[model samples]
Target chain A: MNERQRARRPGGRSARVAAEVHQAVTDLISERGYGNFTVGDVAARAGVADSSIYRRWGNLETLLSDVALTRLNAQSPMPDTGTLAGDLRTYAAQVACEITGPDGLLLVRLAVALSTNGQQGLQARDELRDERTRQLQSMLDRARERGEQAPDALGVLDHILAPMYIRVLFGIGPLTPDYVDGLVDRLL
Target chain B: MNERQRARRPGGRSARVAAEVHQAVTDLISERGYGNFTVGDVAARAGVADSSIYRRWGNLETLLSDVALTRLNAQSPMPDTGTLAGDLRTYAAQVACEITGPDGLLLVRLAVALSTNGQQGLQARDELRDERTRQLQSMLDRARERGEQAPDALGVLDHILAPMYIRVLFGIGPLTPDYVDGLVDRLL
Candidate 1:
């Protein structure tokens, strides 16, 4: 490996620690649900000291927010199908899969629980929404450039994203392929 | 007073205890969020013995479910405007108010947190959904009786209720009257 690459190794100790801690948080949320565990519990599960966790994340909420934001950004890259309908359908379906996965509902519940917390929690919620909105705006802007009629970013959020989120949040029903496509159809 | 009438007074001891316990749960959820408080905390706040609460609700989740269900049922007796469009708009507006009210978001977050707990938590989630569906069904059935083109109850849930819920849960934006009406208009 080149000297510069060696200095910035991807699998460094810090990266390994972060991965372990995140997995610990995810497992705890799945097994016990949100608000039922502590930072020490996470430390124990990850085989790290509580002091190390506190030094890095400073608090439980920050750690939880990091775990959620990291997973969300990593899950679905925005779709670019060269057409608005195709992009929307693909995007919605990917989201359905992400939220229905093993860690999906647990992470979602964590985000919701954090948003109701305090000022810090509010900031985390805003950051997550802004990230999702930014991704959607990029897709819509591309459609506009190609002379396609694209809906507003907020419209997509209300009609497409909101329904899926509410369904997963309340266990309302399954996000079938047809249902995901239907949301995109209705939005268009 | 008549013997039976006196015996079944509205302000009897049982009713008073139930109201106090419900109020206490609401206050705790508002201050601490779900899963942060326990049955003993609720009992202490309600000024009732722990045994009393345990005897009535069986557990913390059940007590929380009771609080949410009672509040939901008590709010906004489903609107019955003559036409489908009118009924939908009115009903949406009422729900907008209910969910944005003091105890609204707290109760919603509680239901969500409970849903991820276990089998008992799943039951609480199902009961909440069933109650909402039952309410929507009555309105749609009335619309059909009047020969109006009524969408299914689930349609109203997806198009109207889900958007408002997601907005509140994530602190996305305000649920203005124009926005609420737009959802109903789109659904119709």
Candidate 2:
């Protein structure tokens, strides 16, 4: 099989192994907490040798970081509606949905686990933030080029999007569509 | 001793115990990962019984949540200035200072760990957010009453403050006073 096909196949050995490993890690984390799971547990659960897992991820932090970031970044990009409000509404809706989804739960758990690690957690967090900011910035840049945004488009974007994440992070108010619309309208 | 005196005594028995426990948890989390630290380790390091920690916090999750929330809540309230911009600048400066301070490090670490736990971290997180939001809301409310703020003062508050927390949580950019001022000028 070609690379793409091999990667997709449920029956393929490598695909099965990777899936098993991912599921094992996820389950272990949820059941045992981030402070309890070990590399050996992951290897045994995945039925792979410990060396194989180590060679792939180098360390547990790197492995979990990859898992968390990949899941978060896998979402599709925001659609452009040629208007700032339209674009923000679409972006906010997608983000809100994700925040209430399984991926959001995983991210919350990961945040708590990383909160005590100082530099290690901060480094991983910076990378995650950079990725999201770059995506948001690119969208804002396009809006500016089209003359469809205000002079403070970046500031507007931060105002509009930041609250949704905060609400999700803090488990405060609902991230409803109406809330997103109100936010976009006011900022725009 | 009075409650105030007990709280202020840096070298008191309770203070020393808390310090030792915090350090132990921090070191274990950094060296062996959050999943590796155990109640036994924490208790032994604190020179207290495991039952004592459990009686106080109930579980590892609850204990960590309390630790994280307490640190964030202990942050000083925003200073009042006649202008919204001035108040925001002061608030942002304080936020930046705290995030860069030792207590800020502890809070950030906890935030990362809590990110993946979903609802597990919501109670503590919500308490912190609600307290800050109330302070900001009151400021905006006063501004509105004084005709200094626009009709949608709450919107302005969210727009200004949400982004700061987002930047801090994600580590996307510096939470400098200038950045806060720019945000206030644009959004407010």
Candidate 3:
């Protein structure tokens, strides 16, 4: 193999290992929760040595943060649907699908745990939130530029989006397409 | 005092005791978490006899469930501002303020615990969700009758309301009145 190809091989291997470790940690947290699951348990679950896990993630919170909260695609490309309603329907449906999925549940659990555990947990929780807010702001900015929305569209986005997450985390109802469309029509 | 009034006083005492016990349980859960706190701990914290707690709430799960899951609204008056936006903004602001407060945080933590515990927890979670949905639906129905809303006006309420809960529970952002107004305008 060429020198460039040889150098790339280790990068690929490390990425695979990272994915495995993240998946293992997620399963462990889901089964045992953040408090009960230990580093040793994650290492064993990931089929890696303790040193490998620690060296990669630094600490359990960091490890879980990476596995649970850090990996989401906080930014979605805003749809240019020509109307606020059309754009929001697309956004709502996509958000509903993601928030109801396994990833969404894990993140919800992590947020709840962190929010109640004092300053350290609260800081982490805030960072995660800030990331999401920036993403939503991006979508709102795009909508304004498209003229499908009014001068201050973020308010609309905030009201419409906030309840869906609440419902999902609280197990309020199905995050169905019909629900998303209905919300889009009424709100936008 | 009459003998009848004196005899009925125990019922009044019992109600006060129940309220105190519920508050104590909520505080303990937020402080120590559901997994660590025991029935004995709850009773001790509540300053009630062990038997009284058991008699009132049945078991640890039942006690926690009742304390954490019970809806707090005791016959609140619905908003009637004559305009859909005005009514929703008022409602959204009220709900937002509550969710951001201390009681709201405790409820959120309990919700996370229940949601993560699998099917048994999910049933309780659904009931909590339904309570909010019913309230929102009622408001929407009222708007439609007054012809202040379109045929599908409730869709706006769903989109506007969902994100606020999501943001609050997940530490996403502050649910301000301006945000609620923007949501109301877009939806209506």
Question: Per-candidate TM-score, first chain only?
Answer: 0.82, 0.73, 0.71
Q: Is the docking of candidate 1 incorrect, acceptable, medium or high quality?
A: medium
Residue-wise C-alpha lDDT for candidate 1, range B1-188, written one tens digit per residue: 77556535789876898889998988887778777888999999999999988877787877888788787777866777788898888888888998887655765577667866678787877777788789889989998898888899878877888888878877766899989999998888
Q: Each prediction's Cα RMSD? A: 3.8, 5.8, 5.6
> If both were scored by lDDT, which would come out higher, candidate 1 or candidate 3?
1
Better of 2 and 3 by TM-score: 3
Fnat score for model 1 = 0.53
lDDT tens digits by residue: candidate 1, A16-38: 88899999998997778777799
**Which of the two, 1 or 2, has more lDDT?**
1
Tens-digit per-residue lDDT, B1-188, candidate 3? 78546534765877688788888887886577777777788889888889888776666655666664454453223477886677777776776777777766656666676676667566666665566557667777787888765424335435555566666766656776777677566666
Which lDDT tens digits does candidate 3 get at residues A129-156? 6666676566667767876554234454
Higher-scoring candidate on DockQ, 1 or 3? 1
Model 1 stretches astray by more than 4 angstroms: A1-14, A31-63, B1-10, B37-59
lDDT of 2 by residue, A21-140 (tens): 888888887677775778899999888999877866776766677667666566647577887667777877777788777556465456545554567765665565566567777777
From the highest DockQ down, the ranking of the candidates is 1, 3, 2
What count of clashes does model 2 give? Answer: 30
Best by lDDT: 1
- Which stretch of 10 consecutive residues in model 3 chain B shows the poorest summed lDDT? B69-78
